[model samples]
Target chain A: MFPVFEIFGKQIGVYGIMAAVGFVACFLVGRLLIRRYDIDIYDFALTMIAAGIGMAIGASLLYAATNYRYLFYGFSHFYEIGWSGLWMCVKTALDGFVFYGGFIGAAIGILIYTKCAKDVKAHRDHLLDIYAVLVPLFHGFGRVGCFFGGCCYGIESPFGFTVHNNHLNPAINDVNRFPVQLLESGCNLLIFLLLLVLFKKHIMEKRLIYLYLLIYPIVRFSDEFLRGDGIRGSLFGLSTSQWVSIILFIFALVMLPIKTKKLKAQSAQAAESDAD
Target chain B: MEQQQGKKGFAIASLVLGIVACVISWWGLVLGIIGIICAVIGLILAIQAQKSYKAIGQKNGVATAGLVLSIIGLILSIIGTIACGIVCAAGTAIANDSRIANQLLDQISSSVN
Candidate 1:
């Protein structure tokens, strides 16, 4: 798969280009979607910046966790390993990222933003509603980036892409891979369309995030089976992402009912007080 | 409103920083990183300026331009960083793996023949 292109005498990553494209698309769509809400556009933009920073930190930390042995060895033998060797260990430990880590980090980032920016917090439900709509749309483009970048590849199969010249992940080279990235991208786009329809019709109101959490995890859980990248550690015979998906699915299932119950209790309390 | 007018200095600073970032991003890795930092600051300033206008239900042309330019600078700086990092990492991998070097060389020689 082609990952890089020559631009202005520099080798620009296709992944970055796709990311930029995704952000622009999200910004335009989000602008339209938020018109119904009282939230400011800059507040939304600032929240996204927080999410981006959080994603970077979380992904790096998870990657380091995956290579803990290397990090330990690097630190323990600091004298013998020398500066270059230590740097090598550190670099190898932190070079890659886990998508699940980034996803969780982004959730925390948004939560933190709402807490700090009280004005934005007042419109929390509306903010989350728009976020739920935009996540899948942006994710679809990211998967496309993964497809071209030859990362997160599908399992080996006869009737699929025979990727070569992928120097970064040489495991992908000269293999007929199943193109799971593109498949997931397509699935994400379909989910995005469904969410968009729901948003446009104002069908789910503030519950769109729950709907997304329910649907996307099922999709992710099933798709994890098709992914060939085995670097992501598994626990209890299930890949990390699959386990995360299951946990998220169950979390949503549990939280939705509790959230509904709380809202109902609050409204009932307000009614009783008003009557007095 | 007064609040919107009060943010004019921020909009101007954002525009200036964004312009500087865009110019320096093309140079190399270190400059690219610095450019990205500048772009980020510019973006924040622009957002603050725009938020003031938006709060009062007004639009500011300068804030819009700053936002647009800062985004462009960020993208450019990111591209430069990606390109440099890729070249470095791939180069190191190639140096260590003889099979990869052989494969690449074979391809080149085959094409030449």
Candidate 2:
């Protein structure tokens, strides 16, 4: 696994490079989408800033939440661990992020933007629908990043890659493991294509976000089963992501029909008013 | 007619901060943290600048540049932060477990002999 590579005597992470590429990709795609969807450019930019802030906060908080025991250990052994040691522990603890948390955070971010910007509030669903498509697009690149870095690795398997001398991920060194990151990346690609098609076709005009919520959780829930990493916290025999998946899946299931019914009623009322 | 000096100043500040962030991102964790903060502030400034430009019915290319640079800086800063964190963790582990270090030294000495 090539976690970090040297360039001009500076170490650069494969994960960071891929994520940066993903952001650029999203920006390019969002530019086109903004025009297509008639979204205000200024509002779009502000909303993205808000979402970026929220995603970072949410992802980091969840990472720290899952590893709170380490914090407790560091706190209790402050003298023993030393300031630098405690700082290192905090850094290591925060190095990991959960995508589900970022998703929730971005959603909250959009909600806040809608509330703050009345002009954009009218087009909330449109904004959400487009952002939904972008999520999978960005995540596709992110999963690939995770693969080269050997962070979100798969279970041990005979038919997989054997990583060696990976100091960044010693756990994966000399072991042949399932390529879950690639699998998830592939899944995200498929989801992205399908969502793009739906959005372009105007098939699920205002409900694309719910569609994403419906699909990704199943993939994530299954992904947890194949993940070999034991860093994330577990509850009731299920990892935090698994629990989040169940909640998001059920939320989509419940919210979809309600949203559909509301949209239908609003359309019917508009049609009647137009005829009158 | 677009004389929002404060907004233009924000855009300029964002651009400068973004440049600063990218430059410092390669220095590793401690400076990486500072780089990240600079990038975040730059991003906020870019967003605000964009708002001001839009309010005046104009697009500010400088703010867009700032936005892009800030993101790139943020990514690089994260990389530096994690890279140094890894180094620090490794150092701590070796300090805590001298056995591994001793084994390595013994391996080297036996090879030399």
Pick the lDDT winner. 2
lDDT of 2 by residue, A1-276 (tens): 788888889878788778778877887888778787677776786787777778877877787776564565556656765676576557655666778878888889988988888878887888899889999999999888888887777889987898888777777778789999999999999999999999889988899999999999999999888887655656788878899999999999999999999999999999999999
Q: Which docking band does candidate 1 fall into?
A: incorrect
Candidate 2: stretches off by over 4 Å: A79-82, B1-6, B54-72, B82-113
What is the DockQ score, from 0 to 1, of model 2? 0.18
**Candidate 1 chain B, poorest ten consecutive residues by summed lDDT:** B83-92
lDDT per residue for candidate 1 within A1-276, as digits (tens), equals 778877767777777677767878988998888788856778888877777667667866765676565576567766765676676667656666666677677777778888898768877777777888888888898788777777787888886899777776677788898999898999999999999999899887777888898999999989888988655667787877888888889988998888778768878999999999
Residue pairs with backbone overlap in model 1? none
**List-wise, what DockQ does each model earn?**
0.17, 0.18
**TM-score of structure candidate 2:** 0.85
Which ranges of candidate 1 are over 4 A from the true structure? Answer: A269-276, B1-4, B27-34, B53-62, B82-113
